[model samples]
Target: MKTRIKKMSDDLLWIFYPTLCAACDRPLLMGEECLCTFCKYYLPRTHFHLQSINPVAKHFWGKVPIQAATSYYYFSKGEKVQRLIHKLKYKDRKDVGMYIGQLMGSDMKDSPFPKPDIVVPVPLHEKKLKLRGYNQSDFIAEGFAKSMNAVFEPQMVYRNKETETQTRKHRFDRYMNMDNVFSINKELAASDKNILLIDDVITTGSTLISCAEALLEIPGTKLSIASIACA
Candidate 1:
């Protein structure tokens, strides 16, 4: 009876507040989660988790050696995926990150994706972190940690230099700019363990490469990458 009453109260509150889908801005129905049924079906998924040599893995070829790479969705410009990214990054909607990460974790739970020793998010520079009041990717990492039962290490590495956004830069420029800009923690560096590197989004895979390079400095450290979405 108590559980039913709480559910009823939550339902009553939603009628007054009208919860909307984060992706499509449609009113959420009784059974819908973060995204509406239409948006969930329409959103492009990479299904990269199923392949050993997916496109995301190919991006790191001849660059960083990664165990595997997967992204939850394919990002298209002006799409609902961007709306989810916007809310998570700019609107202080940290739950959005957790929800996406949980979905990714659930997918990989029974897949061939190797289990990780720990989950680390691409660290944000202190200045940007201060302005944003939180690291959006940290929430992603947390959700993944919970689902995968891995340690969530938010401070495993940090941005040593604040770099320009990679949005307009050429691929080479992005790689060059991010090089040597991150530093891994000694605790993580001293071990030969698998680390699951996480981020909110990936484009040209420059940022993940930079981060993986830092983690590889650790003896016997194997790297795998996961992101909420990728272009």
Candidate 2:
């Protein structure tokens, strides 16, 4: 009875506020669609998935030796992609992250990149996780795992220290501060696995590089990366 009541309540809420696209705020029709048709076709894709040395990979050229890297879309400031990401991170729209992840996963399904054995999302500090009630990267990983037919290991990595936000920090400062912020959970390590590290966005690639650095500590682990957007 409780489950049924909860389902009915959710149904009523959806009726009161219809499902809308994250990109354009238009009502979405039934069947697995997230973005409106206009937004779907018009949104700028990075096409990095099809290239070996794309801009996303170039960001980490000298910093880390990632096996592969790609971003689903190019992020232009003050555009729909930026707005969608803001809502996903700040406004608690986790669905937006998952929706974008699913879209990217579908695109990557046919790409030339090698398949990954597991997906690992960049972890949030315990305090931040408690405050937000969820990790946005975990949601993105869940969507990617479903579409890519790979395992999603939410606890494979963890943030050991809480660092300041990297919003206004210079690139070098970000790299320095983020270096020791992440550590791998030794209990969850799987030997010789190809791990696909996931995050919401890639700016200087500092955060992802930090996480990858920790993951690399584990012997025989290969690392790749994916993100919703690249700035």
Top candidate, metric lDDT: 1
| Residue 142 alpha-carbon offset, candidate 1, angstroms | 1.0
Expressed as tens digits, the lDDT of each residue in 128-171 for candidate 2 is 99998889998899889888999999998998999999999999
TM-score between candidate 2 and the true structure:
0.90
Clash pairs detected, candidate 2: none
lDDT of 1 at 73: 92
Kindly report which residue pairs in candidate 1 clash with one another.
Answer: none
Off by over 4 Å in 2: 1-16
lDDT of each: 0.89, 0.87
**Poorest stretch of ten by lDDT in candidate 2:** 27-36
